[model samples]
Target: MKPYNFRRNPKPLTPNDIENGKNFNEVLKAAGKPPLITPSALKWMGIGLSSLAVLLGLYFGLSNNTEPETSFVQPLGPVPFTSALINPEKDTLLHLSTGSTIFIPAFSVVNKDGTPSKGPVEIKYREFRNVGDILLAGIPMTFDSNEARYHFESSGMFELLAFSGDNPLMVAPGKNITVRMASLNSKDSYNQYYLDTIAKNWVPLGKDNKLFYTGDSVEVGNLKGQNLSKENWEPIKPVVLNPKAQQFRIEVDPKEFPEIAVFGETIFEVVPSEIAYDPATAELPWSDVSIERTAEKDYFLISFSGNGQTLKILARPVVSKSNYVKEMARYEELYKNYLRLEKLQAQSGPTAILEKELSRYKALENQRVADMERAAFVEGRNNTNKSVVYSVFSVQQFGIFNSDYPLKLPNARILQPVFAFENGKQIPATQYFLAEMGRNNLYTFKGGDKIQFDSEVSNLLVVLLNDGSVGLFPASEFGKIPSHAREYKFVLEKVETSELSSKKILSMFNI
Candidate 1:
């Protein structure tokens, strides 16, 4: 049977002489089968060529991502202080600082003159916990501190976003700055490495002291006892992100158990496993020491900024080493006595009154559990302040005692300005101010400020400048801060901690 044949319509072409076309085909056929090629071989060749093209394209495309196609012409101005860019993951970006910061997620970093620098911050994107991933994107970094501005030239492949909020210094212009690599890779540093490449930069705070180098800004100042390689080569330390961003007015919550944190010196401020337990014994302050005990169930901390401005999550519910058993041992022993005495009701018969007494013993046992719950120092996640809470210290500033713990200072009316921030964007509902008892002191300060003497409690002297500027001069640079500094910034001075004599209480019992 003849099958119906179908053919696609041929595309129109310039008509050629049939005779000439046949002659050409005949001549070619006569030429030893014309070295015909197989369709499979042709297909493989096409595929190989295509794969090679893609590989070459990707190599050059990534390498030349940010590089200018044009020759090294006149360099472009720096990215504008106000301009910003973010990575594909939507992390905020930054650049040179005029002394402020911003939190908007941006994409490309434009120059001050409105142009992007040549070259794709060509870093591969990937991420690793101990190490970051490759194929990361780009990130803009900018900050201003002291008198210098720092700019970072970087790719955000695995990079993290530094813009958490408003920072005036990050957006401010006017300083020499350089971004280093060590600030980006330390286990404690801020940025995340997406894949293989790291893109970043740093801007210094002063004109003459702008950052002169950068590689992977490590931010190594906070890592103590850590043997980290500087940018993998140089023996330099990374600087803190916001070493001196001051907040004029701030607030805090004292009842809020603070989540342990360390800014410029340590990795973690609190280690839950290191929690110390009180003695594991129960005493009635009398001769009664017998009691039953129970096992501790769980433990945690709920720290809050003063005034409930912020609620921070601390330790989760975890098994904690506790003395709950030893302390409650007395309850069991007393209850047993009451029960044993009941069996004697037929013999000596004191069960009724004894049961009542036994009840009291049981009550005490229950009290221990209540005490354990009350033993919590901080609040819980259930109760959080919806206001902004700026971290504050108990004392304005606390320094060293004698030589090592010495707090250095220059002539200024104010000795310590601990709770100060530059731009706004703070934890709401928190408040702060310089606390000068009964009266405020005036002072002045300048570069090269140092300590003269060291005394922990001796008050500093205030020096009036010829220009009407007041300065605080540390009388003893080696003095210790007020004792009992537990968290952000509160301390108990010797005077505050001193107990006073009581008379009414002494007479309450007719003593």
Candidate 2:
């Protein structure tokens, strides 16, 4: 076989090899070697490719994650709770610093098993009076009625709870506690509502009766007291003839000196003992004399002035001896009546106060008895008076109660907001709040939600940013937004959560 060459004829260079521009030497070297990739090398190559695929997958997965990092429904700080201890065996009246009052009837609280609870049950109460308080408390102010959602324009809102030795107590059946909640808003349009925690909704009770007094009524009561004080009159002193003292008679003007107007034909007697009076001043030939009332009752500052010089003397009004005798006789009878009236008032003042307090409890007791007889869950009475405005409600359960009017969101303008920092850095917000300047309603919304508000009304927007900072769109900017604009871009001012306070937040909203 012609000394057969051990090297098999190298495969003929294919068209692909020529097109690939492979040199003849490289092709020959490739043919002479065993297959460059062995099983072991292939295994290693497979492992390397798998590792690269996993790293790429992880990179894309994290980049696409869109979940919120943190959600904050409440304010940064804790909401404080006020507590008071009360004996369940007796009716207790609790007063709060906010001027709210709670009247708990005897045996109103019961054990979980429905038996009456004993000992001093601690009553815990708190109030949310402003936008900041409500937001910090995370209390929902929205009301859903008849498939329509509304916001609560609150007059006042409060929460109440009772406990005994760390055990929660329930309100006794057929019994209710009365709450006289002081309200800043004196409007009569609000209705009472109790928050149903289990259902997470507000249950409308009825119209809230507002008790308030007019300024005219208060003035009438004050006038009656003034009239009584005027009825108890005293006699004036008679003018005594003194050879050394100078005295003069003057026709007193009723309008100018109304204090001594009742005494007819009065004479001005100089009081030498007064420190402000100078006896030498009486000798001046005064061109004009003017009388000015002094701090002392029935006394006057008699001034004589002429040629740019003024002389003032202390003087008092006095009646003649005969007039004094006639006035004194009438005064004696009036004084006797005044003494009798004073004695009666002294004896009755404390008794009247005690009776007034007792009457309140008695009235409450009567109402409680009547409610029990009818087996009613709640009972309310309208105790209107000329005093403070009180929004009263009776609760058969321990929970949050509110006096509010449900208001629909303003539909004059609707917007889809895109929140960004003043520096144009976009922030993701999970929730936001809208507060109108004059209205006590707080409208809240979720992310990707449409915000509807009246453009004419001053409004404030607050958003809890994803980076754990507060973003505020102030009220001043509300007027700058075009009414017809649908998509609004809000340039927010970033505020550190630590620097925020209830007063500061309220001031920002102009509450």
Candidate 3:
């Protein structure tokens, strides 16, 4: 069988052609030699033609196998062109008072074909915390040829979500920008970093502020003193996450420990850890200490010299070192002043003026002692302890001093009633306000106040009152009040910290 060939003569063989071939063969015979179309020659031609056909088919098949075949790839879906995108290069932790802005580089939404994807880009933001993540409004970013921008007004971790219409295109890791107190100078400031078990990384918080971490532990100390860089951080203690509870309110029932009765009309308040009191004035008359925990383990019964009054305090489980630091400074200053006054009194003895001045100095001297006791009580946080708690004794009675009173009861109020504004209304004592706390300024509008400002232009104000109350309010500027606001419009509601003496006694003894 001859191999099929397309490129050949168009005309088919005819009988005249065969006859011409036979005449040519006869001429070749007249010259000499055998006939041209012999049986052996025909047989050899058939075998040779068959072998050629097999070789041609094998050559084409092997050539196809040597090189890869080209085909179109069906895209899984529209892909975000992350290759050209860049995240924020600035440090996530910010100490800006007016807040900060971050720029997200322009990135294209491309399809499998490497062409720009069809649809509008939407950017969403939210406040990130260890316990709860707050979701904010999603706005369509003003794309300047694919780039977008964002700003933060408060301190916290913020996350970004970018989408091409309904489909999620990309998500940016949390970008943290913290706003600090405007009055505070950052030259001497430092941050306390914690181990974020959720993220498996170390996170930073302002050293002066109290925070609730959901992680197993957090490392806290002066970054410089500890020689801790971001990579070398470690946890100071394990953090027990209280998901359902955010704060604890401190309440005192003096009847349980009536031994504290000598201090009549005594108002109790929880002091911050920062205060240092005079030691001589802080001596306790009673002498047994018994600390117990409730069944739910939410509250602790801290009895000082069990013989004294037992105060029931509800407080979150977290300690703040800033309080202790501040109190120590006050303690040292007052002690030095008291020593100088004593020397002056000795030099100018027997005079009425010197005596009166000495008496006043003595009162201040007693208060400093109380401060030291309170500071010591709150600053003792073991690895398993929760938050810091203390009591300040303010005397309402001015008569002769009672010998039974717990040595020298401090004249200062540690825990003041904190107020908050929720849903455009004033709410009382919602958050346990820490005394001597500082932050960026904020404002709060009480009922009946017609003050109005462009909410868009207004910022939060950190209001620190003389009574040691700190709160956030909506305002226009840091120090000034909002415009169109009356001077007396802002009502500072009195924080009711404790129950009446009679009522507390009755409840304690079940009268």
Candidate 4:
């Protein structure tokens, strides 16, 4: 009746049992006595099962929850949109920090239901100016025309969006918004295009009008006088005494001609001209006699009118023989004082007093030829500073718009370009971009595709690697490639994701 110890002394298998394939556990179960496991052993088994479950949960959880793939068209850096609140019922003129202007007419924005948008509307705008801006914005510069693909050489580009509260708005039918985009390129070679987001293409929107600044003309003659040196300053000549000529003393108002008032007593001597002045006309108690300066130096146009008759004659200011010697001494003293005051003013820098003094004597200097030449020079200079060229266009929809011209890609091609680091380590790239120095466009090529570029033009090669790092083959290296090479290996400078930035990318290409 003793219990069989299966671990120590188990029953020997019979020939029949062996033929029936009964193992040790089956034999023990059939004998009505099963092996027993202790609580400690069960506890250890539960812990082992739990550990396996936790390990499996971690593995599947990590496999299910992974970071999303980054968008290829996403901007490289932060480009914040400028927002403005505008009343949709009233005409609004929005001015951006870039000196561009947008004219939104009344009732231009409509709701999705085709009803006029009311109350305040939000306008979000941004501009792309330079190559860095365009690259950071991730805007596609390629255009398709007549079954051929061309790149867009942008002059200026902008994005405009409208919203009402949390809902998006659209342009009202038959209404359009006018945009005057401040452009750096003043040339009229660019045309307008509207980006179709859903279609992912740009549609032609006709030619853009390039408007230049037209303001008041700058008077170069006045500026020249104010900018003259003391050595170039010319003093007024002393009045000549012609006693033999028909001369008479006349009092000129000091306020009317302060320049003439500087001279002590002014005598008017009639110059011989086609029209002779009658002495009887001088004593006829003239109703009105006016004196004004003529084109000639020291010459005045004198007109006398009375009893419905008018007489016009050229007269020159003169001094009497008796007063000549005294006036000459007075002139020398005044001239010396004028020179001393001018030197003092020049030392004090440009001031209202100096400008007034210079302007008062500008009429006395004979500088017509010099003034004309300076005027042309100054006009050209002021055109750059005082005026801005604008690319004017009207949009019926709110989206990205560009003033651009389509340019064809280069005919030269290199098939299956192998991109590698400078140390000859091969790296895989997702996309490649070729940017010419003068063109505003960026030509994109897929990996393992043919790379086309102009050899004569300065070209910059940029590759987006599979690991999100940037690789740069600068314009200098691009120029060194031989024209006859069919297969090309691009030696690039690696730019890690942490160091990838708009400024760094621009500097690599020396933009």
| Candidate 4 positional error at 77, Å | 2.9
Candidate 1 residues 1-511, lDDT tens each? 6687766887655456544456766777775342433322221111122232353333333332233221111111111112233331221212222211122212233233434323222111111111001101112123223554332222111122112122111211221111211111111112211111111123211111011111111112221112211111111122222222211111222112111110112111111221231111111122221111001001122332333233222212111124224323433444455456445565865456556645553454344334323432234311212101111001111110000000123223223322211232121111111111111111112221222222323343322222222222232321344433322211211111012111211111121
Q: Answer with 1 or 2, whichever has the higher TM-score.
A: 2
Better of 1 and 3 by lDDT: 3
RMSD of each: 32.3, 34.2, 39.2, 35.0
lDDT scores in order: 0.22, 0.64, 0.27, 0.64
Question: Per-residue error at 301 for model 1, in Å?
Answer: 19
Candidate 4 residue spans exceeding 4 A from truth: 1-74, 214-387, 412-416, 496-499
RMSD of 3: 39.2
Q: Please identify which of the two predictions, 3 or 4, would achieve the higher lDDT against the true structure.
A: 4
| Number of colliding residue pairs in each model | 157, 0, 27, 0
Model 2 Cα lDDT, one tens digit per residue, 1-511: 6867687888998999888895799888875553434322222111122232442333333322343531223444334568888889865667677767677766899989999998789887878777777765556788888899778788778888788876768999988787767755555568889876545578998887543322111111111111212323333334443445556776767654444555667677775433445655665677877775422344555777788876656677666666876655554655566578667767766455546645564454444334332432222112211224567667798878898889887888898999999889888877788988767788878767788888778898888776667888888888888877889899998877656666766777552
Summing lDDT over every window of 10 consecutive residues in candidate 2, give the lowest-scoring window. 215-224
Candidate 2 wrong stretches, greater than 4 Å: 1-76, 214-387, 496-498
Put down candidate 4 lDDT per residue, 153-269, tens digits, no spaces.
888788887888766688999887877687655555578898765445789987665544322111222223222312323234556765555665667886555445545777777
Winner on TM-score (2 vs 3): 2
